[model samples]
Target: MDMQMARIGLFFDGQAELQRWSHQENIFERFIIEVLEHARVPYQMIDDISKFNTVDLLIVGLASENHLIKEALLEYAASGGIVISYGGLELLSQELGCKILPPLEAGYLVLPAEFGQEDPLRYLKANPWQYIDSESVKQTGELSGDDQKSAALLQIPVGKGYVDRWAINIPETIVGLQQGTSPVTEDGIPAPDGTANLDEGILKADDGFELDWEKDRKTTETGMPYFFTPYADLWREVLLGHLTRRALDKGLTLPVLEYWPAGVQHMAMISFDSDMNINEAAEATLQVLKQEDVQTTWCIIAPGFSKEIYEKAKVDGHELALHYNALEAEDGVWSEEAFLEQLEWLKGAADETNFTSNKNHYTRFEGWGELFQWCEKNGIQADQTRGPSKKGNVGFLFGTCQPYFPISLADEQNRFYDVMEIGFLTQDMNHPSLADTTIIQPFLEKAKRVDGVAHFLFHQHHIYHLPKVKEALIEVVRKARAAGFTFWTSKQINDWERARRTLTVSANGRLEVLGAAELPDVKVWIPLADADAEERGLTYKYGLPGKTQVLQVQLNKVEL
Candidate 1:
C-alpha cells in the first residue's frame, strides 16, 4: 500500500443493473463518477472483485441482490475496507443488522447543521427512500416528510471497517434535483409564489423553477432576504465530506483539486445582455469593465451595436457570445433552424468565427433537452439560460452556481451534453427596494461556500439606464476583487474547466497532466495521513503542524 495515497474504486454491477433497470445509462455509475470528477478526487472504476484489494474505499452503486457481489462486499468489509452503498442494500440488511422498511415517496434529507445549514435544519431533496431502521448502527441523518421521518444515513460497523449507506437512490434524486424531475411541457409549472406568470407560453427557465419559494429561501442580512440554499451542490458536499471523514479516519490520503486557479478561494463572472443594442449603453458598460480591469461575457442580440463597438470589445478581451432571441416581439422563432441562423448572425456581427458561450434572450427554454441538443450540435461550449428572470425567483433557482454539463434524460444512453450550463445568480440587480450590497454580498458568499462561480448578469441598457444597476456592478467587481477573485470571461472559464478535467493523479502520487495541458495557476492539494512521515516522497507545500499537508505541484511541470 502507498502510505502517501489512498485509491478509491467505484464498483459497478452490469448484470445486476440490467436485471433491475432497463435504462441503458447506469445513472448510479454516472453519478458516482460525476461526484468524484467534480471534487477532483482521483478514483478508478472497477467491476471485478479480484481488484478489490487495490482500493482503500469502494463505492458500490446499486447494491442489488446478487450473492457473489454481496459476498465480495462482505469479504472486503471484514478485511477493513470502507464502503459506501448508494441503494438496494436489502441484500446486506440482515448481515449489517438493519431493517429495511417499505419505500416512501419523495421527501427531504435532514442533515446536521455542521454541513453548512444556516438554520438548525437544512433539507436536501431526496427521491423515494427505503427507510432503514437499526438501533446499533449510527444514524447520521434522516429523511423528513410532513408526516414521516425515517433513518436515511447510516454508518454500520461491519467487522473492522464500516459501510456508510444512503438509504435512497442518490443518483436519480441528484439528477432529478439538478435537471428537474419533470420535463418542460406546454403546460408550464405555474409559480404559486407569483414569480413568473407564464401566460403566453412556457418557454423560459423560470417556468421550470422547482424550489418552493417560502420553504427553500433563506433570510440574509440584506435586501429581500432571499438567498436560496443551493440544495444540489450542498448535497454533493455532504457526500464528499462523508467520504473524506471516513478516509481520514482510516489514515488514508486524498488529493482535492481546488476549483479556482492560483489558489483563489472562489470565482466571479460578470455577464451583460446587449438587449436594446444601444451603442452608448454598450460603450458605458465596456468602460465600467475596463475601469474595473475586468473582462466580461457580452451576450449579443441581433442588430447588435456597430461593428466597431464589437471590434473594440473583441480587442479588449471580452467574450463575444450570442444571446438567442425566441420571443415574438423580437420577431424570434423558437426552432432549431432559427437558433442556428441567429448564431451565425452573431458570429458575423462580432466578426468572430468561434463563440464559446451563449444565453437565450428572456431565457426562452422550451423543452427538457432540445436546447442542449442544439448547443451540442452547434459547438456551443457553454449556456447560461437556466436562471432567474423574475426578482422573486432569484438566487439559485436552478440549485447551483457551478457550471455543469446537462444530462440528457431523453437519450437512451443518458449521455451528458457537451455544453456547460453556468446558471446566473440574478439579473439586473436594479430592484427599487433592494440595495445592491444586499444581493451582492449573499450571492457571492453563497457561491464561495459552495466553491462555485458567482455569476452576475446585468443588461447593457440597465447598466446605463438604472443608477442602482451600475452601482451594483461596480460594488460586485470591487468586492469580488477584494475577496481575491479574478473576473474571467465565459470562454476563459470554459477553457480552464476543460483543461483541468484532463489532469489525473495516480495511486503512486504521480500527477499526470495529459494532452500537454499547461495550467500553471492550478493548485493540487493532497491531504496526508502523517505530515512528518519520512516515507512521503512529495514535498509538503502548505499546512500547519498536525494538519492536512498540501502538495502544490505546477501542472505545466507535469504536462506530457
Candidate 2:
C-alpha cells in the first residue's frame, strides 16, 4: 500500500515593499527553489496564508514583521501542520514565552552528533541570525561562539505541530559560498606583472574562484588545492535530511527523484578541449574514448580538425562544442564580438548550426555573470569552465560536483541564468601528484555520496603530445566504469536535468512525466508508506533502516 505523498508549500509574502523582497532581496527565494528542484522535492508556491491549511509542510522563507503571517502560522501549527521557518522571531517571542537577542553576522553552527555531522557548518556571509531564548524550545544545535545561550537549531511546539527554525539565513550563506561573497571586480585579483601580454585588462577564471583559503580550504598530502569538505553541498544535505525527517514524523515518506537516469548510483562525463585543434590530436583522444565504449563531449577550437574528422566524430556519437579562446591566440580577445566570432567559427568547422555545451580556453573567465549571460544568448545549454586549471587547484575547489544553474546577482525578476554550469573536478590529470588514485578517488566517491556528476577534463593537445596524459585518461575511464559510473556527453546531462525538472508526483502516487520524450529511461522511486508493504510484496530500499519501502517506476509509463 502507498501512503499519500506529503504536500509542501513554500510561503512567499507578496507585499514586496513590506518585506523588501525586490529582485536584489529575492536571492533567498531563487536559491531555495533551486535547492528543492535539485533535491527533486516537489513544492507549491503560495503567496496567501489562506492556502497554508492545505500543505502538510510549510516552508516560511521570510515572515518579516507581518503579524498576519504570524497569526496564520500559529493557527496552521495548532491545526497540526509542520513548519520550517527562518527569521521573524520577534513577533512570536512573547506568544511563545521567549526573548529575542542580538543576531550574529558570521558564525559556525555546531550540529549535534544525532544528525551525523562531524565538522562545524560554516556560513561565509550571513543574513543575521534570529537569536531567541526559551526554556520550552528544544535546541538540537547551538552556535559555536561566545554566546553559548544562543541556539542554532530550535524546535518549538505550538499546539499540535512543531516549528523548526534555523537561526542563520541558509539562502544567503549558500549563494555566497557558491558564487563569491561579492561581485567579481576587474581589479579583484591583479594579474602578474608580465602576464598581461595585452594592452586591455582581461578577466580570467582565477579572478572568480571564491573559496576562502583560511577557513574553507582543505589541504591534502597530494599538495593539490582540494577542498575536501563540500560546505555548500553539506549544508544542502542538512536541509534535505531535516525536511525528510519532518515528513517521516508526519507519517509521510518524502519521495526524492534521483539525479541520474534509472537510479544510477553515480555518473561521470569526460570532455576534451581541442587546444591545438589538430586532426591527429583530436583523433588520438577519440580512439581512447572508443576503446572505453563511452560517448564524451569535445570542446572544439576554431579551425578545428578537417570536416571529415568532425563528421567521423559525429557518427561515433560525440558532442562537438565550442572551445572559446580568449587567451593568447590571434582570434583570442575578451570581447562579445570575439566570443561570437570564435563560436561561429567553431560551429562552421564542426558543420553544426548550434552547440549545446562550451568551455573557455585556459578556463578563461572575467567578471561575474557575463559568461553565463553569453551562454544564454547563444544556443549553449551548459558550460564546463568552473574547475581547477593548475595542478595545485584540482578537486572540489569550487565546492561542488553537481551541474547547477548559476544565479546572476544583477538580474531583476530572474536571478538564475538559463545556462547550466557543469563544473569539472580537474583538468588534464597528467601531473604525477594529481594523476594518483589517492587524489582522484575522493572526488569520485564524494560525487556518488551526493549523487552528482563527476566531470573530468582532458585536453586533445596533451593527449597527443604526452603519453602519461593518455595513460591517465584511459585509467580514469576504466576505473569510473568499473565503479558503476556511466559516461554521458554534456548535452545529455543538461537535457536530462532540464526535462526531469518538469516531473511531478501526485498525492495519490501517480507519476507525471511531462517530458517523456527526453526521459525515456528515467526512473522514480516512490516509497511504500504502508506498515505491511513488504508483506504485500513490496521492497524496501533507500533511506535509513525501518524507513518506508520504495518501488521503482519507469517515468515514461505515466505521462502527464
Candidate 3:
C-alpha cells in the first residue's frame, strides 16, 4: 500500500458556493490553481454545500461568504480542518488571526480608463478589477499597497483543522509581492502620508500624501510594464535577477532539509572562444582560478598540449571541454557525426558520462541541435554552445540570458519550458576593444526580461590577457546581485529545479516527473563553488537494493 499523505478538504464561503462558479473568470484563480498544483498537495473542489461537512480544506472566495458556510468554517477550524480564504475572504484572516500580502497599488500604475459594464465589479456595489503584472513588477516602482500592516498566518490545528489567508492579484502578484516587484496590498491604498521608509529619505508633499512624480513627469509611461521599472534603485533592487527568497516562502515543505547552496555548491563554467593558446601562457589565469578556489570547465583546443600540459591543467583544477574548428571537419562527415566524435574525444579526457552539458567547438552552428541530442546521449547534463555572443547570430532558440528550453525541444506540457532560455552571461567586459558597460547593460537587461538562471560566461584567457575583465565581471556579478538575482552553476540550477518537485505515484498510478529527471541512484559529482568540472572519473553498473533495480554511477568531485 502507498503512503496516504495530506489530502486537503475545500469549502467555499456562502457566496462563491451559490454562484455555481461559471468557470474561472479570473485568470488569477487559474494561476492560484497552478501554484497549488505545483505544490502537489491533494485537494478537491466542493461545490455542493451539503458535502462540505467533512471538508479537509475550506477555500472561501471573498465574495462568496454565507452564514451556513461561515458557521461550518468556524466549526471545521475548531474541529481541525484547514481553511484557506482569499480576496474578500481576508475577513477570515482577521477573524482567524493572520494577514495576506497587503492590498497595495502604486500611484504609478497604468490602470485602464475604460471599464466594461459586464465586468464582475459592475455586478456588485464593490467593483472587481484585474491587471497583469510584469515578471519584475516589484522593482523600479514603489510598493503602493494600502497601509494594512496586518500579518497573514497559517494557523495549524485550531479545532479539527486550520486556516490560511491569501490576497490574490492574479498568480504573479503573489510572486511580485514576494519578489519586491509590485504587490497587491490589503485595502488597495497607498500611504496617505507619503511612501515612508524609516531609513531612506523620501521626498514629501505638504499634506503628507506621497506625491505622484510618475504622473507629473510622465512622457512615456507605456514602455516600462511594471509601474516601478523607471526608478533606478527600485529597478536594481527588484529587476536585476532571480526571486531567491519570495519563491522559497510559498514554501519548501521539507522543513529541515539542508540548503545545498548554489553559492557554495556551484561551479561557474568559463571558456575562451579563440586560441592557438598555450598552457604555460594560460597558467597565471588558471593559477588565479585555483588560488581563488574556483573550478573551471576549461574549454581547450587539441592543438597545443603535451603530457605535462594536461598534468599542469589537472594540477590547477581544470576540466577540459573541446573547442573544435568548424573548417577542419573530417572529409564527408556530417557535422553531427563530427561533433559526436569530438564529444567522445572530450569524454575520453574529461569523462563526463551521461551528462548533456557542452559549449561550442569553434563556434560551429551546423546541426547544433543534433549536437545537443548527442551530448544528451553521451551523458552531457546540459549543452551551452548556444552561439558566440560577439560573433554569431544566436538563433533565438534557447532564449536570451536565461536557462530555458530549446524552443524546438521544449516539453510542451511543462509550461516552464514553453519558450525557455538561460545564459552563462560570458563576455570580456574589461577589453578596451569591447563596448564597455553600456553594452553590458543590455546583457544584464536581457537577464531581467524573465526568470531563469543567468550563468555568466567569461574567459580565463581574457583575464590572462587583461585582469580588468575579471574585475568587470565581478562588478557585473555585484550589479546582478543588487538586482536580487542569485548567481548559480548549471548543476546548481538543475538541482534547484529538481528539488522543487515531489514524485507521487498518484492515486491513479501515474509517475510524475516533478521538475527534472528523476535520477535517484544516479551519482553526479556536483562541482563545489570554488571548483567546477575539472576532469572527474565515472563508473556505471546495475544492482538490486530493497527489491528495486537500479543503475549506479559516481561523479568524482561533485556532491549533491
Q: Tell me the TM-score of each prediction against the true structure.
A: 0.87, 0.87, 0.40
Expressed as tens digits, the lDDT of each residue in 1-560 for candidate 1 is: 34455778888776765654565444534666777777778788887888887999998875567788788898898899988876556688777766656576555665665444443223334332332444657776666663445566778777888887776666655666567766676545544655445554646777765566567775546535454677667667666666766676787666666777655657999898998999999989889888988899999988899998998898898889989999877789988999999999987877778888999998888767889888889989999998876666678777788878777653435567888888888877764633245777778777887778899888889888887888888988998888767788888889888877776654354543233454555555555545576554553322211222233444454444
Relative to the unseen true structure, what is the C-alpha lDDT of residue 186 in candidate 3, on a scale of 0 to 100?
A: 18
Residue pairs of candidate 1 with colliding backbone atoms: 203-365
- Which candidate achieves the best lDDT against the true structure? 1
Quickly count the clashes in candidate 2: 2
Per-residue alpha-carbon lDDT of model 2 for 1-560, expressed as tens digits?
34567889988676742345354544454577888888778789888889999899998865656788889988998889988865544566666665566666666777866454567777653222332455666776766553545676678888998777777667656666666666555533422332212223545565555554455555456544455656677777777777767887888866666677665658899998877778888788778778878888988877678898788788899998888888854557777888888888887766689899989987777766778888889888899987765554567666677778877653344368898888888867765434444556777777776778888888888888888878878878888888888889999999988877777644455543334344444545454433463464443323322332233433465455
- How are the candidates ranked when ordered by TM-score, highest leading? 1, 2, 3
> CA lDDT of each candidate?
0.72, 0.70, 0.37
- Superior candidate under lDDT, 2 versus 3: 2
Clash count for each candidate, listed in order shown:
1, 2, 79
lDDT of 3: 0.37
- Tell me the deviation in Å of residue 21 in model 1: 6.6
Q: Which of the predicted structures, 1 or 3, would earn the higher TM-score when compared with the native? A: 1
TM-score of 1: 0.87
| Stretch of 10 with least lDDT, candidate 3 | 116-125
Decoy 3 TM-score against native: 0.40
